[model samples]
Target: MHLRALPLDRAPVRLRQWVFLVDADERAAEAAFVALFAPGQDPGLGRALVADDGGGWLWERHQEFSTWTWFAFGPLGSELGFEAQPAETFFWLYGAPGEVFRGVEISVSAPEAQPPSEVALSRHIDLHRCVSCEVFDGAARIWTDFRLREGGTGRIHVANHSLAHDEVSRLVQTLLEIGNYRKLALIGFPPARELLAWLDGAEGRLASITSGLATGEDSQAVLDQLLALSAEVELRAAKNQFRRGATESYHRLTLDRLEALRERRVPGHSTMSEFIARRLLPAMRTREAADRRLDDLSVRIARSGDLLRTKLGLAQDRQNQETLRGMDASLQLQTKLQGLVEGLSIFAVGYYVLGLLGYLLKPWLHGWPGGAEIVLSGLVPLVLVVAAASLHRRKKRLIAGRD
Candidate 1:
């Protein structure tokens, strides 16, 4: 949709279908072209090395979606709509090499937010509420038609559904003072009773559609749709405004840091070198802010997982140490049990040997007690050894537990 880009004093890029121009001085234009619309920076979709076809550049500097669109200048008074054929040698300028003019056409129509009735179509030219996808099936056109005329610096247009009387008038007045609009016009229907009075005050050919078939009429319905679309756009813009403030604050600090580093350019650290080292991270940070919030969140989650894993490892290590101590204690208990079994075998062997010796000595010691003494000596040594081993095992277990 071709509307005008008016001065800031006027309403900002208003409505769904309009264009406005910037009356930049040569220097301003040059600076804007150099700083904002650098060549090879594709304006559509993503970075695919686009060039300039500079009739004039549209530096769309919204808070979030910053972009530049280059256009080809046409002769004054040329028909400002789609043409069947495009001129071969249209003027073009671009930063990228081997990219000149490409023929594209633009069209503008009045707002027809709803299906036009037979009667309404007969009376007035049916304007589409906005451009459709069908219009740019091939290459798209850069639509710019609103320009300054009659020495009017800029123009402000309050759309057909614009309400808020005091606010609208204030904005209109601001647009006038700021040299924003060339011809400001408020297109709307006042309240019916007020509109009747307004129409009575109207001179020849009052420029308004005040009287209509109430809100149910197709035109009114279309107007409603357009206003709703415009409002949604405005709300999105308002939300972006807050984001822009935060972004600007962050970048402003970053640039300030860069300037400080530049001032401290040392013997070894070249300015370029410093920029490469310090500025690169911040630039990456900026890009991440714009495009990688989810990625950043993912990174944060991963870091959190790592921390948890570390904590779990520490706990697991402590549990393992306790397990090792328990195993050591169990080994000591098993060793003691084995030793006790061996000692029992040794005692049985000793008792059997002593018993056999007594049997042998019984006939020789018929009047002696040497056989009994031998048995008692062997048994006492065995009992003392068993008791000492048990005490040693209990002490070892106590030490292991303390350790």
Candidate 2:
């Protein structure tokens, strides 16, 4: 839902706002919001604003983190009351729902007769790292060191000149958003840095695996290594996927807020854009590089797997061909043995038939004994030829049936 608009009658002379990055789930954060600001009221819209005696409370819930802003305003000479309030003051009163990631303190004041010197600013922030710029086309000036103090809060000072109260509220809101998103984006940095060394080692391992595949090393072993590497890579990617995506989103929003400021740089001093370019942009790039590397590694792993599978398939085909050849040889030998056995059977049958004929013709051929012997010798070739022809025909019929 949308943020509730602020009701401002006039520009505040002095304002102090505290921005907190709450680390909690949506349910717990909403509960905390209701408890801290509107007891018995639901923040179904994800944002709420509450006004009290000379102060206001605004809280918004986001996907990865939530922000709570507390602001107080008073007359120009009125002493700003929140300077003594520590970062834990809110948690102590409302019962902390979650840990805080980033805390920012913003103070707005009327332009002084004399601007604070660099020496005075140095007491609160590093003078060398301080950033100052005119924003809203010189309607106001902003200063900050972007450094956390002992209370774990970064400070921003805005000097108001001609802006209305509503404009100042919008400006503060933008400033708080920039800080919140910047810190949220940085959540990806540490993990990315940790992954740098891991990515280096993983890349080397992948290279070695690829080399082994190219060199025709053991296919199964190489495949196992690739699978293991893929699993590890996926695990790491899954763990950091949300953070990387969130970082990119937050980075873009931070840039948008900086642009919304319409900053004009102060002479001899860096602006917020320059400060972010020097600090946050590099971290964003590092994370982007890690994401690209992870993707590249996955692609290479897939390619290696495909290559290994092709090799395995070729090797299996070769083995199959060899097996077929051996089977063919064995079949040929069996055919030859079957032919020899058929020929022997034919000769055996002929010999038995000759003995029977001899017994039958004994009476008639009592005076011609050599006749039977010559007849039997002539019929021997005929019987063998007939037997061979019959076996060939039978074999042909069997083969035809199989086909």
List residue ranges in candidate 1 displaced over 4 A.
1-103, 106-290, 355-403
Clashing pairs in 2: none
Per-candidate Cα RMSD to the true structure, in Å, reads: 25.0, 4.1
Question: How would you encode candidate 2's per-residue C-alpha lDDT over 1-403 as one tens digit per residue?
Answer: 2244544434442333343445444466456546655765567767666776677666666675556666666743322222555545364235535556777776666434245556655666676778999988877888888888756778787777667647776777788788878878998999998898799999999999999999989998998999999999999989988887889999999999999999998998898889888999999999999889889989988888899999999999999999999999999999899878877877776677667766776667678768767766776777667766776788899999999
Q: Which stretches of candidate 2 lie over 4 Å from their true place?
A: 4-10, 13-26, 29-33, 76-82, 86-94, 110-128, 214-216, 345-387
User: Largest lDDT belongs to which candidate?
Assistant: 2
Error of 1 at 56 (Å): 28
Give one digit per residue, the lDDT tens place, for model 1 in 269-329: 2332243335344443543343233233334334433544555577689999999999999
Candidate 2 achieves a global lDDT of: 0.74
Against the true structure, candidate 1 reaches a TM-score of: 0.26
Of the candidates shown, which would achieve the greatest TM-score relative to the real structure?
2
**Cα deviation of 109 in candidate 2 (Å)?**
3.6
